[model samples]
Target: MSKVKGHKSVIFDLRLSTFDACLLMQEKPKVSVTRTRRDSAAKEFSFTADSIPAGGLKDVRAKAWDAFTKFSMPITTDEAWRRTDLRLLPASDFKIPKEGAFEDLPVVPESLLKPLTGEQHGGQITLLPGGSRVDLDPDLVSKGVIFTDIRTAEREHTELLNKLIGTIVKPEDGKFAALASALAGNGVLLYVPKNVQVETPLHSVLWGPGTDLAHFSHLIVYVEDGASVTYVHEAASPNETGHAMHAGIVEIHVGKDANLRFVELQSWGRHVWNFSHERARVERGGNLDWIFGAVGSRLTKNFSDLDLAGEGSVGRMSGFYFTDGTQHLDHDTQQNHLAPHTTSDLLFKGALKGKSRSVWQGMIYVAPGAQKTDGYQANRNLILDEQARADSIPGLEILADDVRCTHGATVGKFEKEPLFYLKSLGIAQAEAERLVVEGFFDPIMQRIPFEGVRERFQQAIQDKLSVDK
Candidate 1:
């Protein structure tokens, strides 16, 4: 793979023996490893490359090894990650699961895996750490569409992979992003040939085994001119308590007149610190839609960036988040209008209960000469308890005098009137709260493209609102 300008490149030769040994390593709390200042009092934890091997096998694995060692990881104190306590993560204890990590882990709960595994989800592929081969749908390959694991892509589509990976989202952008680049391992790459359209959505899963082991993966998607596709990714950890580092990147390119819908769900275990960057570039007349959901993790930092480079292009961004039990979720979003007559819309809703916290920072930029641009952004949050907290910052910058730009945000508890009305109808207080929460989340669900996924998300929100734990 080619290196970026002014950057040195390193390789990780991932081998079975080396990865297995690392996975079995005992958890050793090294909050000091991520410490930014030597004299600081706060505790933090980061993946230690010295504990992982430098070379063994696999070219892509070697690149990951190089990243873990060269890239600067973040300490918990980093402003973006300060709210999510990393000290609780057992990063120091994780090891790569043996060959059985894929099958050994509990069958992914049907509630979560059903939407992704079926033939309707477009195509489904699974990746295993330390060298796992993936099988793709032959029908797609017959259509000249390339959907495979990143490792295979590197070997077969090296030039395309290098041009797209690590370019859209840089690890140096933030602590979480940087860590993902440094530790990237197995991921997926989907390429749609020019003018071809895939009606169904594509699904891929990234599974990291062993306790306290670092899992880094990258996704690179290219939609050639006049092509159409949708992709979904799910990240989760079955083991309850371990320091599993999940850092991943997703880069999408929408060619002229192409259409792409992307969905991502983050459900890393409570003990995991999931950091990711999702971005896309829209060519002239292309269309892009993004649907994101963040539910589980001790702390998560996700950025959604879209660039409208083509005139008359359209983009939509919608997000849903539910945080509880001291969890923290941070989101940074940008809607950039660089061409004339482009339209963009953004809506994000979050509910924080228990001691959980969430932050939404969204911005819109309309460049000069980008007249007739229509841009809108809105964020709403419902705080379910006194201990719950939410922060929303929505802003806009317009250089074109003839542009339509608007942004708004709101943070409040369930409206007392609404709750009372539900209770008066004979609904219990808990049930009343659940109904109100659903009302808050329902509008956003309308934007999801997949009915099956939307149903699951609605049920997830209902469960979160009804349960007190």
Candidate 2:
């Protein structure tokens, strides 16, 4: 398992012990030669605490398996995983998700079998193939609101699950969120207590069934203080092509004067494989609104983050994505403004066709005493096919001496004077390029105020602008 170019990664099937995978490359020897690297893997901190299924937190899962063996995955030496490529994944011959049922998986879709919003929008959770099903609104659980099943709140809410599980995307913070904290086991929890004002809106759906499976999902949202909620998170795949692997973790905590509204949707299946890590933290005078949408998977790498920790906090992030054929979608985003009149805003939009490829990297940070911070970031892309490719990178960093940061990025194609002004009004250059690509994704799907995830993101942009491309 240590042959240079004949590569074998996905951490060589996770049971590490080649001197614990070279312990952080023998202490960061220049991160084992990076710059455009092509295979220099090692950084294992070993995690396999009997694959954790509630065994009294064996000392916090042995420090989350030593932060998933100190973060390791060889996406050619991580420059934010340099343009995502896992050697066209057969990811070390996929394993992990076995405990099958639901009559041996694969067949979902009676439109994802009920509940994609419409229980007056209140509570819902659906993760099938042997586990997960949650339903709420017993008068908001008689007013204390602790929506269930994250291993049943790790056995009846252990003091709010040991103070908010892994405290903001930890588990060595990388290496596929330390392999989703070493194999995620049944997740879903939404607790909105203090000043509770739920007024209907909570939903979750994560599905991964047969064919070479490996699916892990975990979600935690705690909105307290001046509470308010509207949540929805989803991931779906089934209808095999043989090869499935999804790694996920989403953790959000918005307290002091809290209010949170997040709606996320990912449509996986194309012999899926997605790596994920999502985060959020906003305190003093908190408020966060995040809405994101991604079109399926055949290879996706995601990294999302938002931290505006305290003092007049507010964060807004909006995203949209679409790709076709040889799909590969990658996104890395972050907006951090730690305290002092904080504010952060980010926007992302995408489009691609046939020979598919998409990647967006964004960042805006303002720390150092954060005084008067106000940050902004933007990314936009469109390329209908010329062997489609899009990459937008935007960044900004300020060690604040009173900050107001800004960043922007754009990758283009498909703007022939707005498709020749909608084809001189006679419309029909394929319906004026599908109404100019649905008006270029209608302002981030109308800022997603969750009307069933903006009607499944406008029925997935009218089935990719009525295909035929």
Candidate 3:
């Protein structure tokens, strides 16, 4: 709707100090289109227990570890991390998952484990703090579809795994990414061959461990030309006795004329901290649809990107997040158009209650030769309490004169007229409020195709509202 001043104006809604916000933006927000280059090559790195080792990709693990060792944890001084405060985090206390028996792990809830369909759900992958299990459809496997755990895939399909990992969301791209790349031992890898379409959606769940623990995870999906697939990722945690951390990475590669639908649900405990990076690249004529739901987490800082690299490609991103209590969530999103006739649209909405706070910073960049591009991005926030806070920043940079790009952000609350109308229908005040909030998120919730996943989100929303059973 409205364009802020390049990248500077929208970034003003920061929780960091004024001086820090200015330092991070430095006039226009700096965006990394390709691999990030920092001072890390000179540092020495050693392999940990969880370091994945493959035939040809051995060097990748060592290199990523070296970067992580050399890289310093982000602080308020860094521009990308200026708005996110981690002063209380015990960064030095994190340890790589050790090799041992994982059978004694805690039991996860059944609601989180069950899939919507019996076997129609293509597959289900369960990842823990130290172990993972993948069960795919045997019928699909006979047709050349590869869906398995990342470590196993490394041993089997080393060539394909090496080619895609770090190619899109490179290890050196950011601090969190480097950490996940260097040490994450458990992950999922799904590859759909060319011209093959799998109607059923695959699912993955990351269940948290006990207190004061740290886990690194990864999920990589590669869809070949003319192939189509859908994936559902759910992150849930049990109540913790102390602070916990879950740092993860998600990489998606869509080949020419392919299609992929991705869904991610984040619902951790109040003492859990989540930091992750996700990116998707669509080739010529490819299509990518992403749906993200964040209904839990004590504190979260996520950086997600979309790069439309091929002409005639299409990408859409839709997300919803609700923050209550003392929760704090910050998201920095980027959308880049590098080729002609590519289209991208992003819509993210959030609702804050109690003393919770949330910030969203988004940017859209179009390259010089990217003509006839249609791109739009927006973030809308609903603040339900006077103590709650929500900050939205949206911007665009167009080097191509023929491109149509627009961005806007809005911060508001439930209109009194709507509430009054619902109350006039004999609805209780609490029910009326919950109804209005659900209606607000209905648009984005409808984008999720799976019936089971949608119902799970609905239950989470109801829980946040503290609705009666």
Candidate 4:
């Protein structure tokens, strides 16, 4: 029951009376509704003390609340958040899914229940509405491995959780992360003890029902010294479902001489607004590899941040995205080299069709003391139609003299000659287009470490390319 001022936002509904609604501002303070029309009126609501608490970050929440008291809506017009349709995301309209909704839910998708076929993939584990609790094989656990839910792990393994959480992706860094920390209900916790080598991959899935609800989730992983692990985070909404929101945060830590490979896939309902933030840190002699396949969702925003924190650290990331219909997908990534002899490389490619739009903005920064740093970034896009659009922004910032950095971006179309040649071979246009797209994405897909995920990536692309009557 604090006073949070309203701002000059657009009016999507104008038939109600005097605006007096009270809305949650994610991590910000209480937000009040403003008069948009004589008939438009806002309604007031309250949060009970018994509501699911968000205390893991009480101090940070308080500081954010204090800042919210000082700063109100009609936020400073920052370019980073320009594409985000906050008008559709008014906090008042957002709420946690009712517990009863999950009581009698249908069985999980069969695809999820089937055991993973790839070599060393994590087996089936606990799946929930907003979070997951995965039980790693006891054999692996005996070798100093740790895998479980974030909440339980935080309670039982405080030191491991404390040392990794919020360190890679700080909650205060952005509104999405802040909101996720303030409202997230579930998450995954994974730890690989020092010097252990587990060549298998851990997998977790997040499924949301189409109920116009929101589920903020988090994922934290730590690989101790000389250890190795791979992780996959998959998200999807059931077919034909409508209007849902999924906001999530993921953090991965690779300690000295350790290696980590991470993969992420997102396919949500058409009405869902998907916002996710992923961050990773690499220590001395550590190596980090990342792969992402983005599909589905009406509106989506993602950020991937990598920090090379120790000498000789290395990070490599690659992704492929397919967008169709009126969907809007945006990705922003950063690579920060903070130590000497650190290196990082990134490549992202996307294809847009059916009047959709996609944007890619990536940056690489080499600190003043990060001598002998090597960094490279690239973004490439293929536009299939005149109405579909793509945007790319790749930049580099260097304060070190002994660094080698390079950045490039390109947005183009599939070569007509290749298609024509395929047509002459008696191939239909649809099939020909599929060939071109598959080839365009193959470079990155071939590099994916797991065959099962790579096949999923291919299937996603094929699904997007299939034209509907």
Clashing pairs counted in every model: 19, 4, 1, 9
Per-residue lDDT of 1-469 in model 2, one digit per residue for the tens?
1111111211111222223356646765454544433344422323356665554344665677667766546564457866676765665666565455555666557675445455555777777655777888789999999888676787788777777887899887787786676567767878899998998878777877677667777788989889998887778885466787888889999999889988788988878888889999999998999988899888888999999889998989999888888889988888888888988878888889888888787767666776877777777788888888776666666665666666666677888898898789878787788778778878886776656666777777778767655
TM-score of each: 0.82, 0.32, 0.88, 0.84
Give the per-residue lDDT digits (tens) of candidate 4, residues 1-469.
Answer: 0111121221111111111112222356667966553223222112222334454544544553343333232221445654444455434555676544555454457685443436555533554664454667778877867788766776677676666667777666676676665556577888888988876667887777646577778788889999988777777776545466777889888999999888777877677888888889899999998888888787888988999999999999998898888889989898999999998989898998888988777778777788888888877889888888787766666776776777777778768999999999999998998999988887787778677877888888778887551
lDDT of 3 by residue, 103-222 (tens): 555766778877753345688888876677789889889879988887788889888888878877878887778878866767888889999998888888888766666777888898
Cα-based RMSD of the predictions, in order? 11.0, 23.7, 6.3, 10.5
Model 4: CA > 4 A from native: 1-76, 113-120, 123-126, 130-133, 239-242
- Which lDDT value does model 2 have at 123? 78
Measured by TM-score, the strongest candidate is 3
Between candidates 2 and 3, the TM-score winner: 3
How does candidate 1 fare on TM-score? 0.82
Residue pairs clashing in model 2 are: 44-69, 45-69, 46-69, 267-296
Give the Å shift of residue 32 in candidate 2.
Answer: 17
